[model samples]
Target: MNPNGRRGVELMCTGATSNSSWMKQLTSASRQGRHGRVLHLFFTSLRPGDRGAADTHPAAIPTALRACARLGDASSGRLIHGLVLTRFPSLASDAVAATALLDMYAKCGLVASARRVFDEMPRHDDLVAWNALLAGYARHGLPERALTLAIKMRGQGLRPDLVTWNAVVSGFALAGDDQMAGDLVRAMQDDGFQPDVVTWTSLVSGSVLNFHYDRARALFRRMVAAGNRVLPSSATIASILPAFANVTDVKRGKEVHAYAVVTGVEQNLTVSSALVDMYAKCGLVLKAHRLFDKMAERSSVTWNSMIFGLANYGHCQEAIGLFDRMLCDGARPDHLTFTAVLTACSYCGMVELGEGLYRAMKEEHGIEPRLEHYACMVHLLGRAGKVAEAYDFIRAMPLEPDCFVWGALLGACRSHGNVKLAELAASRLRTVEPANAANCLLFSDALASAGRQDDVVKMKRLAKRRRIKKLDGCSWLESP
Candidate 1:
């Protein structure tokens, strides 16, 4: 069904009569990221009663398995496994073919199935198969299993290599076991394998994931200061940028940006996208926009960040315009895209447009409205002084409204002086998030705004009885 894959296979099959030629085409398509083409070629080449097609194409089996691994098409991988069992049973004894199957299952998160393939391999001495299964366990949050497997592998006299060490280290790092990950790094160094860019990037990424932004930045600095032995790759740049973005540390962000530009990774898609996001979160919308516009390629992340930046800064129309351009450029909008544009609509009081897009999101784009989408709608209608309409919208919701939905209604009721609806919204919000004193505070404010001093006093007494105290509000300010 993939048009490019189908077209590529059809055009190249003109002289692919021999089994080797068919394998060349399959592997070529996979390497080109045309995994769909590889599948198409694989299945189509298996003719009716053509046992030779399956039996002779031993090389094609591993290539197809690799494609299945990349695509995460486990069902197709199973089908190929079945074919190998029925038609090309000799492939079951081939180490390369069996290893490919093991890797495909592992990458698809089928650790058990990958283990079965690894165990059933004609030879257990294949280092590549061991690493594939080890990585599968480690990558899937079973670092302990990976370590045990590595010990067993070493018992079999197969020395652990750089890939094996990095796999275990990455597993611990990704699981947020920084102490264990560091110990593993030192251990690998003792084994005469110096930590490379993958090792450092894993540490940096793990720190970022755990919200240890300072530690992530420090590790990045250490990696950079390690001289020419290992410089920050694009992955390293992309990983550390989020730490800066989350903290709104534009100074460090710009320093990293300068590094990226000097290292010629400025044009890399992921690095550029992260830069756009970093600038946007730092409140430098103009700088974000400039970087966004200059990019030759923009992903949904790039577009969403720029749109969100514009919407957050009161440039609602510009945000909406950019969304239109995104559609015109044939970029598929995801849920975040609609969230960004709906936010713009709410900010600019474009209630009708928001409604249309909400419907289009479900009908045209097939993206079901999530809780955030419902919350945005309530905000759009409520802020437009249509408090009654917002209440009706909440009533008609397919799912039960959450705290954000009722909170939007309560906030709207307060702004528009709808005391009755405000009380209802606050009650529902309290039921949804009972511990949040902010809801009670807003409801009390609504009562005060409606000149109901007696009701406000009663609410205060209720709050005191319930032991609900409003938390102090704080804001993050840019450093001087």
Candidate 2:
């Protein structure tokens, strides 16, 4: 035996059959301190072939089970499960321990093992087991499986409690299945389950994913009217706030901010970040800046959100200044952070700043420039009428440039009336996106603008041959 294993055996040999409470102390220490070694000692202290081990209290088994779960030691959990079987089979029958076992298996990513344990349980009446399985499915991105299991659970005459319903709703919302999630909410209401804050939050998050901002707002209103004591979490606020960004109705976004204040979720990091993003997206960069300044604590995500918000609203200088401040404040830039900063440079035609940041990202921060960063560079150079330089930059990139890069170049060529370069960029774009009506239309427009009527006619003929139709114009009206 290994020396450490031998030492454990030697310790066990001395106290193999002792009821001196040392075993109990060791077991308690393992549970309290989450020390796996103490548990090893406690288990080894049990006499070999001790038939009376099963007489241990059920409470002791949960403590051990919890220790195994916390440590995420599946082998220890399995061994403990066997010990429970041999010493106290009744512990396995205990609902709480069974749930613990299910949870342990789930946490270890052994959902199938958890399901087997669930199937073997004598009583399926345990709602905790059902919830554990639902949570397991949800955590693992098996939303459809979770939904199917939930339906089966209901079919078996088991009414889903609030936790079970929440799990299914959250699973669907996260999976981007807003319609199915909404249907489930309607079903829950039909089944006489009143919508709680969790339910409303789930619906709002799902609606936001589907870009149904109005529905999200309406649900928020209903949540307030219901007066359920269940408060909205920061996650709920974050999810819905971004939906208001693209909406022209700044008034609705302000209403959301007011609700956040009233509900006391405004101070939460997620909610605060969302408020900053919403204000910037709605063309209220000053409000966003004010909120950012007032935050007592800021995470990297908080800084990134403000940077992106400022960059998005054409406050490029302010964004660059904030980026510098973020670095000064010891916040490291993530990929999205760099993307925002690069976009800011692009918006302000600050090619030098963009190029410097790009180099710093690769050399200093060890972050490789992504396609978006390159695209931003292309847009920056193109906007400055350096079409040839932009084309060379795209050609020399480490990775293949996508249609966006070519499109940016083509737009630049059109602006500078470079017919030859426009044709070259459009030709590359056509191969990548054969059915792109916008590319054809833009190429035709460029040709016409350059007085190349013959080329324009030929391009129109190609569009007709490809059965590409020109886009129709439409406008949208947002509800106040």
lDDT per residue (tens digit) for residues 42-91 in model 2: 56656667434423333445566667667777887888788767865655
Query: Least lDDT summed over 10 consecutive residues: which range in candidate 2?
Result: 1-10
| C-alpha lDDT of all candidate models, in order | 0.90, 0.78
The worst-scoring run of ten residues by lDDT in candidate 1 lies at 1-10
TM-score of 1: 0.85
Query: lDDT score of model 1?
Result: 0.90
Off by over 4 Å in 2: 1-133, 139-141, 151-160, 174-179, 186-193, 228-233
Tens-digit per-residue lDDT, 1-480, candidate 1: 111121222333344445376667877898898998999988887867655654555667788999999989999999999988986676676677788889999999999999998877756787888999999999888999999999999999999999999999989988999899999999999999999999999999989988988789889999999989999999999999999989888888999999999999999999999999999988899999999999999999999999999999899999999999999999999999999999999999999999999999999999999999999999999999999999999999999999999999999999999999999998898788988888988999999999999999998888888888888888666545
Using lDDT as the measure, the top candidate is 1
Q: Positional deviation of 272 in candidate 2, in angstroms?
A: 1.3
